[model samples]
Target: MESISITPTIINPKRVFKKTTGEEWYNYYAGFSDDFVSEILNSFELPKDSVILDPWNGGGTTTLNCALAGYNVIGIDLNPVMNIVAKSKFCNTDDVLMALDIVKYLRVNNYPNKLNDESDFLLNWFDYNTASYIRYISFSLQNKCNTILNSKVFSLIFLALFKLVRKYIGKFIPSNPTWVKKAKNSNDKISIESTKIKIDLKNILREKLSATFVDNVSSIGKERFYCASSTKLPLKEHSVDAVITSPPYCTRIDYGIATSPELAVLLGNHPAEIDNIRRTLTGRTTIDKSFLEIESLGLTAKKMLLEIFNHQSHASVSYYYKNFAQYFIDINESLKQIKKVLKRNGYFACVVQDSHYKEIYCDLALIFTEMAEENGLSLIHRQDFMSKFVMANINSKVKKYRDKITANETVLIFQAN
Candidate 1:
């Protein structure tokens, strides 16, 4: 395949959806399309034995895609729930039937009436009946002493079912609500019958997992997954052949808080554990105030921070940029580590977007590219992709808030010199 030029015009988010199957699962913003990954790998001319690394592997998209492309892959994420998900998707298995059987056993035998008193968040978010049922299933699976070959299968089923239940029953609000006050007054209603919702959810899980497993068995190559911070990867120096990842944006999306309920249900963690989980995450709301000192170290960062502060309130801008700045510094450090491990002339591909903070556009991709160049990497290609999904609806006041930020994202490619 001819290598494409890196430019902002190459990315068409609308086209991404148009090219996909249009399935509900494919529509998920957090999940990457398999076709997109394949295209990226082909463009890179990845060797069959190339070792690929995805530092922020969300939903196992990059890891699984690498496996399908005949490359050895290592995926790292801070979320243990995602670790389970990635493992289930990448690990090869001979007998999916056994996995389904294990799920059946769990479904029949597990039913806890009382949760640990420590789970206040779970109790708050989930009605007792729903909580107990989910707990029973999770407990049964957890107590299974044997490392059942179908553990991943069960986990996928649980995750898929959890999503379905949330969607149908309106168990929680969407992760980002630009205008919470207006949303409350809208005509939308939280509605879904519990029993019907559960059955529908279970059926979808069984179907999706069954199809996914069948596809996985037919694919080639081996893949590995890890649960750790990307800034501190466990791999040895010069071990990987390439790097491909899409780091989180600086848009103050509290991923941990947004997904807290889901993680709690998946891990069966008590409510008390939720706070610990959120606190451990890296992003806008999670970071402490002391990180602002980095401004003295990087001129570009100082300029970006100043711009952010100029448009948004100082407190809000600081709240968003504190962690993002750290994330950049961490990425710079990670790239140094990446340079050590990656083979000479190895490729580094990143899909990133310029995000806004109250209309103040922060060119994070450009900033990171400059940082990477300073750390001994050379920028080879930069492409801008259009993100069609409006961050905030036009008529809403949130759009006015976001217009102060950025409107689009970009993808950049770098190479080890």
Candidate 2:
């Protein structure tokens, strides 16, 4: 099938990932599709030496697409789990098989790899045996075998562990798939049969991870992803040729809580570890006690903030107003960082949606345009597609706040001045 040369009419803006394979490693509640990234790359007809950057590299959709297209890509995310996941894309059969050989060894020997990382978070969310098995697999994957398994191989194994853990912790995940709750009911014993899981794990990892994606590593510019914050970027000044990223929306989504299960299963099992990450992210729910008054957030943000402050809805002034203020603050700082890294005349495309604080409209697209311009990014093009499905539409109670069934997903294209 021939690829769409022209950027398609925006549907959900974030996926239909089935169009591309191997990206189904993790289900992201807030990630754009590979098809969308392909269109952006094609439509822009970027320079041959162009280096792509996905600042908010949720689930590796942008980074993976860039790799397939043979562009040098860098994917960054604050969540450590995402870095492990993004790197998994770089793995081939050799890398995956090596990790599997280690797994085979561990299983055959019955490695008593206990979950010495006594985790209250896991205890509240998962059955002891289930969590222990997951921890054991993760620890084994992280082991130093013959000068330490290559980053790609370890990441592939870690991704496999995530797949296994997701099946056993079904009871904790709520209506919103991202939101994982604590303390399963005693009646609801979601126990994993160790024998069945071993079979499932082998089948899942072997079939998925062994398949090759990138045809030639030498032919293409390499992809590098890191567990880094977007606000404080790791790239050098004027290093990036283009930035293709969808910054977190101002909807106050807790990105940290969304990936709590992955964080608990692999990196850190403490709730504070999760909360600390949440506090650092751009669109996270937590608030700072000594919040800085941001003057550079632009006129559009100020007006929206004022409207939310005066709104009559419950908690509109106290909680909702403050939440949006912090988002704009972080976003303002991020735009500045983006401008610093983008080469002159380079392209920057951002996908954003409008939200509501009760009846007050938070025109995020307009706000972002203003903020980007303030940071030396000149607006070149803009397209708004009415999104049939949005996060707000999922909640029945949202109808009371606004009768509108859908939101507009605006793609703002800009050039670095």
TM values, all candidates? 0.80, 0.90
Residue lDDT tens for model 1, 1-417: 123343322233222444221223322355445655666677777678888888888767778778877788888877766666666664223334445465554443334554766443444455555556666656666666333223555555556555664554343454443212111322333333445545665566555543453253454666776667766888987788778777766565666755654566655556556566565554535776454456433566667766755654656565555665666566666667677777777777777767655665677777777777877678987767666564544436666565442356666777777
Question: Count of backbone clashes for each model?
Answer: 17, 1
Model 1 off-target regions past 4 Å? 1-27, 91-96, 107-110, 145-151, 175-202, 213-219, 289-292, 295-297, 309-324, 392-395, 398-406
lDDT by residue (1-417, candidate 2, tens digit) is: 111124433334657757244536666667777778888877767656678998988778788878777788999888878877878877777776776776665563365646656554556566767666666666666665331123877777677777766666776777777577777464564567566666777776787653556534555567887677888999999899888889888777787888777777665546677778878888889887766686778999998888878888788777888888888988888899999999887788889988876667889999999999999998877888787876776678888867986788888888888
Off by over 4 Å in 2: 1-12, 19-23, 108-118, 145-150, 209-211, 216-218
Clashing pairs in 2: 14-32
